[model samples]
Target: MFNPSPKQFKFIKALLFVLALLPAVRLLVFGFTDRLGANPIEFITRSSGDWTLYFLCITLVVTPLRRFTNWNWLIKLRRMIGLFAFFYGSLHFTTFLWFDHFFDIAEMLKDVVKRPFITVGFIAFVMLLPLALTSTNGMIRRLGGKRWQWLHRSVYAVAMLGILHFWWMRAGKHNFEKPILFGTIVAALLLIRVYFAWRNRGDGAAKSRTAVQKRQVTPTLT
Candidate 1:
């Protein structure tokens, strides 16, 4: 397997950092050029939300890809990719809060309570907040590896919430295409993790049983 040196890994990360920001940059360019269609707010909101899902999908895919390809360096990029997911999620939420609600907290609360899609989206964004805040190495050390991993596992739930949000929102318009596709991708990514975990547990159990059998069969030492 070809392992990336530190410098090569940094270069890859830098390239991905820029590539990930392109969606936000495109939104900016479109806004400046008055190309956000007739409903600028809706366009911005949808675009940001779509990119959030895309990033989430990419973030979730990283682990499976790394394991399958044996490119351990790919794990280093996961934090950045995950943060980008949160970044676009922030943008998506900001559009709804700033443009849709005009910072009216009461109205926003009412909307969230009244609409199931908005409710799930609000919860998903709120869930992402903690994950993003605790993404740093310092935070990981502070939380400890096991605790940090447990907390970060909420990301799977967040992705599910995000899919539900999108699906419910599109239900009103009878648009199932994109929602179904995103749901399938997220579901498959999550199931891949589950499968590996189960297989590893089985492998460990088998090893333990083999060791026990060998010990039982061996003659006792004097």
Candidate 2:
């Protein structure tokens, strides 16, 4: 209903691209202005991680929004929004590696093993890596539609892992509010997809039964 022309769609996409980067730009501005507060590294880490989760939520919402609203153009925007999720996730990871461990792989590995939250976050990031790498059109062609779709479905797991990582991280400090809210949103989004899938499967089975009944009736009538 609110469809845009090709040129307008491109402009809208470009605008979304700029808007996605605003969080990162804000972080840089804050750093330069010394507004990151007493614990700058921790502040940067938390802020970037929060934005990563926010983008993930937004990316997950796109499909459901498109289905309910019939905005087919939203699919075109999904790739960019998903990539932004990876971007913020990478930034969050970089903050840990650069500021927290100073690029010490051994120490990072040790911490990843030692901390449950870090382990979950590490696995989530590792899973996100392949998704980002195979997001190109060429890769999609190479992987084939079914396989590519199967691979991308892992985003559901990534979303769950992200929530678990955040929950565990906050467990120590007893800060459960934000994590609970995010987890609920992610859970609801996943459930919507699951419900549609289940309903479609039922519909397919019902149609098969009707076809069988029609065949039997035709033979008896004959």
Candidate 3:
């Protein structure tokens, strides 16, 4: 019932687009100016990848937010947010492949097999590719609503894999703080979804009971 004006929708899109670009802009400036401290490549790659996971988590939160807030307009931004997540994620993957591996296919393959963190991260990126490819309106129509919904549920798995990747990557340095924070945010978002789902089921049951009671109480005309 709460529909946003066309202007409001456009503004929202623009704002999110700008916000999504800010990180990349910062990274580019840092790279060009030689501003990355210590390990520049690692800093850029991790920062980009972290933002990608952040966006992915935020995109996942949109559904539950819409339902809980009853602000249906939020649905309009989910696709945009999701695609941005993929964009950042692609950049993250590319940075690692190009900067770290230097396009060495053999070394990259060996690293994936040897490092668990890389393995999970690679798999998460692979999962995101199909989702990004199908983000268009045409793909939605072709896949149909139900099938598309099913396919996109892969984001849940992607999120878990991403967190695991982050966690394991940090484990090497014995720095659990950042990964724990990310895991906490993701877990909180997921718990919100679970709570709302249970609440909706209860509301549905109550509505059904009320309808049945009303039917029983009504007198037949004949």
Candidate 4:
């Protein structure tokens, strides 16, 4: 019912593509300029992780925004946003392994097991891997619609774990501002989906009742 012209769709895609590259571009510039401030590795790690979560939030918002705006073209950008989220997430993980742990698998595994925040973050990243892998059209087709949908539903859990990771990481400092903001955004997105699903079910029931009423009226007419 909601469709965009070909030209409009192309423009939207191009805009999103440019937006997705901005973070990587900034990272590169900062690296070259040695401008990472105080703790360079920590700066890069936190920046990438923040962008990953932000993009994930935006990706989740696409569906609800599309429904509200009646602009189906927004759906076309969802995959790109999701993949970019994974891209930043990979960078975040790499910064930890390469810069922090110096590729020390044993130490990293030990931390993952011992630290609840890292444990949750590691689990969230693992969950995102499959979603990123199946972002392709061919993979989606191969997985079949229902199965793919089920697998992607893990995003909800990923979001929850991500917020928990952020929350626990900040627990020592008692600073809840950033995590609270992120949590609120995730909650809003989830609530939108819940509301729409319930509304759709009601619509379906009403349609069924209408059909039944038509059948009963037809018998009387006969």
Top-lDDT structure, candidate number: 1
- Per-residue error (Å), model 3, residue 39: 2.3
| lDDT (10s digit) by residue, model 1, range 98-142 | 998899999999999998889999999999999999887777778
True-structure Cα RMSD, model 1: 8.0
Go through the candidates in order and give the clash count of each: 0, 0, 0, 0
Window of ten residues with lowest summed lDDT in model 2: 213-222
Judge candidate 4 at residue 117 and give its lDDT: 96
For each candidate in turn, the TM-score is: 0.91, 0.91, 0.86, 0.89
Error of 4 at 137 (Å): 0.8
Better of 3 and 4 by TM-score: 4
Off by over 4 Å in 4: 1-3, 205-222
Writing each residue's lDDT as its tens digit, candidate 4 over 76-158 gives 67888888989998999999889989999999999999999999999999999999998887777787655777788789889
1 or 2, which is superior by lDDT? Answer: 1
Our model 3 lands, by Cα RMSD against the true structure, at: 7.9
Model 4: weakest 10-residue lDDT segment is 213-222
Which residue ranges in model 2 land beyond 4 Å of their true spot? 204-222
lDDT of 2 at 212: 43
lDDT of 3 by residue, 2-100 (tens): 676888778878998898889999998998998988899889888888998889889888877776787767777888888888999999998888988
